[model samples]
Target: MFDVKIVNGHILDGTGNPWTKLDIGIINDTIVEIGQLKDAPSKETIDAEGLVVSPGFIDTHVHSDLLCLRPEVHKIKVMQGVTTELFGQDGISVAPVSSETKPIWQKQLKGLNGDIGDWPWESIDDYLSYLEQSDLIGNNTYLVPHGGARTLVMGFEGRKATKEEMTEMRKIVEKGMEEGAVGVSSGLIYPPNIYSDKEELIEICKGAARYDGCFVVHIRNESNKSLEALEEVIDVARITGVRLHVSHFKVAGELNRDKFTKSLQLMDEAREEGIEVTFDQYPYTAGSTVFHSILPPWMHEGGTEKLLERLKDKDVRNRIKEDFLHNEDYENWVRNCGWENIVIASVGSEQNKEAENKNMLKIAELWNTTPEEAAFDLLLEEEANITMIAHWGDEEDLIYGMQHPLQVVGSDGIFGGKPHPRLFGTYPRVLGEFVREKGALTLSEAVRRMTGAPAQLLRLKDRGLLIEGYKADIVVFDPTTVKDRSTYEEPLLEPVGIKYVLVNGLLAVKDEQFTGMTAGRVIRSGVATPVN
Candidate 1:
């Protein structure tokens, strides 16, 4: 008998093909049959009349590294129909940490990934093993963060690695891939990763390529130097033969908007040259990240603690202000998008909670200080745990990227106070606004980007589709009614029209309510099962 039967649904199948009317039968954790299954015996049956049953969305980029360990808080992703998520993004995350570096990473990542008190695991294998024992709402995969790997060999040092140190770092990454990381990810705009030169990236990519792993990166620059940044990573991929994926790919700042087309042309040229490359992007004009990123890379040289110490210095503050105004070498957030366009999204301290949704300029006005000082003071008070949203592009540019053949959906969601609405609304927004409302993309094509495309990129063997023999990771939603309700003002509001979701064939969400059943497994590279 079937474990669960879903009948009267239009199946999209995640293959970029038009939908077909069908019914699905699930037993245990796999889809046992896909046909007319209305009379199939089952423990539970869902009448998915007028709903689209497609593969549950795979979030290719997320900052849920620590949040995934906390079952209650992390269900937000699954609630929005995400059945699997990729963590260890932008070259920094939990896991593979030494006792000495663990505290440092905890502070550095607190604003981005949140602090869950103390982490109990120290390696990729240990971290995945812990996830195997946790009550996870959806499946999770990881990348060997370049920053974390570098920290294991050298504790957030900002200098070139010697020959021996380079070999050691490569070994660290190779070991992580062996432990089941899908790839290696680096955020070139962040510390440790920002310190790495082109040669260092080639060495790291070589290690990941040994396991046929992909190299996912947030390239060095996304504004004025955007095209040059793309060329750098493309060159690394060419040298190492590592599968390359860009994270939250976008050209930031109004002045840099014209470079978007040229960037796409470069990616196309690389593909023509037989270089395997792909990218993920959220459907938003603004970008979000830790507020400390506004400071120059040199300020983050010694890690979060040293950064805080430097922030307290008058001379350092002066240097930082000068860099924010003039630096074109690094990602100058303040210069690309003004302080008025940069709004505080979240803060770690209750004392500054009122500034959550206010722009830096307004906050500075309230504090009766300069915008730079207000930013510095906030970082000092919060000990560097602050998140911000900077308005970067227009909807026209967002739609242009969305229509690209290589693009996939990744929320790049950062949690905590007045978070980007993409955190809660990304998937539905695409399905509703882009696909349904605007006709920017067809429904079948949109689902493919969120499902089959990412699944193929990550090398998930049996997920991301609705084939009879595949795992039953599915989402049932009303096409007519599905839409994201979350906004900048009401970022916590849940999306509408995602009626049911299944993870590993277990009903995790029914009628938009969580079933409290944690059937998620820690998916590893080339395998759908947990690490054993």
Candidate 2:
């Protein structure tokens, strides 16, 4: 008798193979058999009569490390059919942080991570061990956040690393990898990390590559500096011979819209030059980040207290606002730039909880001031804690980009209330809308993108496939009904049509409901190439 038998299902087998009729048998947490199973007996039998079973979806980009410590880990993501997720993208994470720096790190990332209770570890390995003890509901993976590590070793000051500092940083990456972090990640567009030049990155990539890990970067900026950032990433890959994964590789702002195709051409060119480059982007045009991210790097050099001091100085505030005025859209007094479309995804401090859905642009208009000044004031009032969805994407660009072979789907999601629906709907949106509904990709091809492609990039062994001996991580859904219900307004709504989701062979989500089970394991990269 089999431990569990899923009978009469259309198996999509994550290999991009042709769909086949099969009965999958699971014994404990592994798929024990496939194909005909007419007489198979088991402790449990699921009559998957009309369901289309595929490998459980894997989210390549997630910011759920600290948030998953919450009681439910937000069942919204699990119910949407994501069985496994890679956390620590764009560099901010709980691991690799010393206890002394954890609080400051938490506060700095509060807008992105939302408020969470105290963390238990000061290092990546310890954090992973603590997570293993948590009542998590789904599979969670870890990445050594370069920003977190840098902040721990050097604080938030923008400076070049000393020789000893470089040694310390390399040790941090090595320790995290030894403890199960899949790779190294950076947020170069954000804080102290932005201070790092190409040579520093090359050194760090070399360390990560020693652990067979990849380097993932929230590339410098997709604006005027997009090409420069791309050049920097390619240089790192070239210098260190590391694998490069570009996070949210979109060209933002209307001015950069025409540069989207050019960005792809650049990446393709890098690939041709033997630089292993891949990128992930959400299907949305507008991007979301902390409002404080717009602050000058110098203003944020010392941390929150220093930033608050600068905010209090009228001269400093005016000087900063003067610089921001050149941005045009936000310079016009009382202009509601993207307000109608800007949904407040998260608010970090107790004082700013009321700003969760109110528009910053509208608030600027109410104060009869420039949007930049309004943003500064709002962030200052909340201690630089706010999140906003900037409406700045072109649908044509999104569609065209997703069609690219090297482009994989990513939500770039924050685990917070009213967060971008991409967190809950990315995989299904690609599977149902883009693949089935729009006919942009064959179902097998889409599955490969969400499953195999990312698994390969992260170098997760034996995952992202449906082979008999592989892990029994699977999903069963109805393609016709598998549509994302979470819209821009009702961003927290759950998706429909996913019937079951398994992580490491245990049902994490069943019948479109969370089973309150976590069967995830941290994946450490074993490649010897530099990970960028």
Candidate 3:
């Protein structure tokens, strides 16, 4: 008898091809057979008559490291049919660290990931080992965080790395990559990483390229100089011959939205010049991140302790206020952060619960002050640690981005007490809202973008496609009924029409509910050998 049989489903196969009817047979953890199975016997048979059976979704950009440590994180992702998630995004993760840098990183990243209790592991392999022993939700792939590596070797100081310090950091990257890390990541817009120059980046990325890996970067800026940031990324790829992937690619400022065509043309021009480049973006019109991201980059050089101290000085505060007023696109930034569109999603301080769903502009008006002053007071009151959303980007910008052949999808949202809905609703919104309802893309093309495309980018062999002898990581869903129920007001609701989600032939989500199963394993890269 077969181990399990999913009968009579229209198979999409994840190749952007036409749907074909087939019966899928699974045994242990692999797809044992496909096609006619009329005479096959099985332990259990699922009647998926009206459902579309395809490879489980793969999330390209994710920040669910600590969130997945909680048991229910898998449920939130699996119910939307995501079987695998790429963690260690935008250069922040909990690996490749030293004891000295652990506490400093925890405080530096307080606004990004809240309240990390303990340092569970030291190296990338060690961190993955800890997750393997814990109750994780799905398969996780990791990358060596360049920002964390810098913090470990060179504290939060804004200085160039000496020869010895550079060597130490490169050794850490080599060890993590040897232990199966996919690549290295950097967040140039954030501190520590922002302090690094082109020489430092090129040296490290050359090592990553030696292993046939890609370096992913959250570009230096996402606002007025976004095009220049894109060019800089291309320059890095050209200098080191490292494959490049840009995180959350979008034109953010209101005036910059008109330059989408120009930015895309530049990317197209880069690809033609033989620089391998790809990008991921969420489908929403509004973007979200910590409110302090608007601060002048230099003001955040020394990390949180120094930032808090600077916030208390009268002269410094006045200087910062003047700088905010005189910013080149200050009005566009204000419009992007519309009071009604900006929501207080999470806060470290207990006093912040009352501010949820309220906008920064409204709060500023209530206090009879400028928005920057209101933001400063709120951050100071909350100890420079709060998470807020920016209502930026136009719908046309998002649609134009997705229509590109090279673009993939990702949710920049991460979880805390209460989080943005994209973490739970991104995949469903794409399939239901854009493809099924709005007809933005055909069903076949949407499946390809979610599954096969990202898997190919990660070089995940025997996954993201349905065929015999491959891992039985699959999902069964009804395209017509699938929809995302989560919104800004209520961000934790589950999606509909996803009936079954499997990881390695085990049911992670069954009947639209999580089974609390934990059978995920960490994926590693192939070994690098010397060229003759």
Candidate 4:
């Protein structure tokens, strides 16, 4: 008898083709058959009449590293039918830590990646194994974090790596890859990742290249000189022959959103010259990040404690204000988007929870002070753990980027107070609003981008498609009613119309309710490669 039989579903198969009616048979965790199975015996049966059955969504960029450690917290993805989520995004993860820098990274990363308090893994293998031994909700993939390795070797020092240091970091990357990391990631907007120049990046990429792993970068800049930043990464990819993947690709400031067309031209040129380049973007105009990130890079040299000290000093705050108001060289997101555009996504303190989702300008008005003073006061009070959302992109550019062939979807949101709506809404919004509502993409094309395309990028041969013998990672949903209910004002709400989700033949979500199953596996590069 088959383990489970799903009959009468219009199967998309995640191949970018039109839907075809088929019955699917599952034995254990593999899709045993894909054709007629009506007469076949089965232990369980699902009538998928009038519904679409497709491969579960693979989130190309997700920051659920520590959140996944808590079982029910992952319902944010499962409710939307995400089967696989690739972590170690924007260049910071919990693993590959050294004894010296372990405490430092744990605190520094808390601004965006929430606390993991005393969890026991330092090396990549140990970290991945810890998850495997835990109660997981969905399949997870990891990338060797460039910043984590840098912290181990450089300790938040804002300087280019010495040749020996670079070699040491290279070994870490290679070792992580050997132990099953799919790639390496660099968050250039966040330092000391920003400290690395082109040559250093190429060196790191080379290690990932050896294992046929992807080199994913959150590029150095997304504002005024965005094209130049794009060029730098493209050249790095060209020189190293690394499979390049750009994370959460967007021209963030209002001043640069119009330049996205030119940016696309540069990427197209790079691809034409034989660089394997792709990018992921959330379908939102507003972007979320730590509010402290807007300060001058020099102020961040010694990490959050020093930054907090600077925030409290009147003279230091004034000097920073002067430089920000006058400097034309550096791309300051706050200045470019205007104070009115910055909204508080969350704060570290319980008393300030009421400030969640309020814009900086509104807070300033409420406190009877300038936005600059209000911001500094907030940072000083919260100790640099305030997160903000900037309303700063052009709708035209967002649509243009989404229509590109290499574009895949990602939710760059994390768990905490008043997060971005994309945290719970990205996949459903793409399907309902982008596909069914606006017809921006056909159901087949959107499904392909969400599933098959990401699978191809990560070289995950077994999980992205709903073919016979592939892993039974599948989603069943109604095309007519699937839509995201989460909004910026009500960010934590779940989605609607996702009927069921399966991870490796086990139901994780059934009829929009979590099945409370821990069927997730810590997927490794090439299916569990051993470290040398």
Best by TM-score: 1
Write candidate 3's Cα lDDT for 333-361 as tens digits.
44444455666677777876666657876
List candidate 2 segments past 4 Å from native.
Answer: 327-343, 349-354, 524-532
Query: How does candidate 2 score on lDDT?
Result: 0.76
Determine which window of 10 residues in candidate 3 has minimal summed lDDT: 328-337
Give the lDDT ranking, best first: 1, 4, 3, 2
The lDDT of each candidate is 0.92, 0.76, 0.79, 0.86
Ordering by TM-score: 1, 4, 3, 2
Q: If both were scored by lDDT, which would come out higher, candidate 3 or candidate 4?
A: 4
- Residues 1-532, candidate 4: write the lDDT tens digits: 8898889989998889999899999999999898989999999888889999999999988888988988778778988989999988877778889787778777777878787688698899999999999988999998999988888888888788898898888888989998889999998878668678888888888788888889888888777877888899999889878888988888877566667888888888888999999999898998888888778777777667777877878898898898668754455777778888899998888977877888888999988999889889888888787888888888778878899988888888778889989999999999999899888889999999899999998999798999888999999999999999999999999999999898899988888889898788899998344222
Candidate 2 C-alpha lDDT tens digits along 1-532: 7777788888888777888999999888789899798687788777788888888777788887777666475676678777677888787777777767878887887878777677777877677778777767667777888877787778987788886777778778777777787778988767778787777787777777777778889887676567777888888988877789998877766666777898899899999999889998787777777767666666778677688778888899877766554543211111223445555667666765665665766666767886666676777787777777767668889888888999877788876656777877877787778888888888877877778888888877777778798888888888778888777777877788888888778877778888778676655455434334
Per-candidate RMSD, Å:
2.0, 3.0, 2.2, 1.7
Candidate 1: C-alpha RMSD after superposition: 2.0
- Candidate 3, TM-score vs. the true structure? 0.95
Tens digit per residue, CA lDDT, model 1, 342-377: 999999999999899999989999999999999999
**Alpha carbon lDDT at 377, candidate 4:** 88
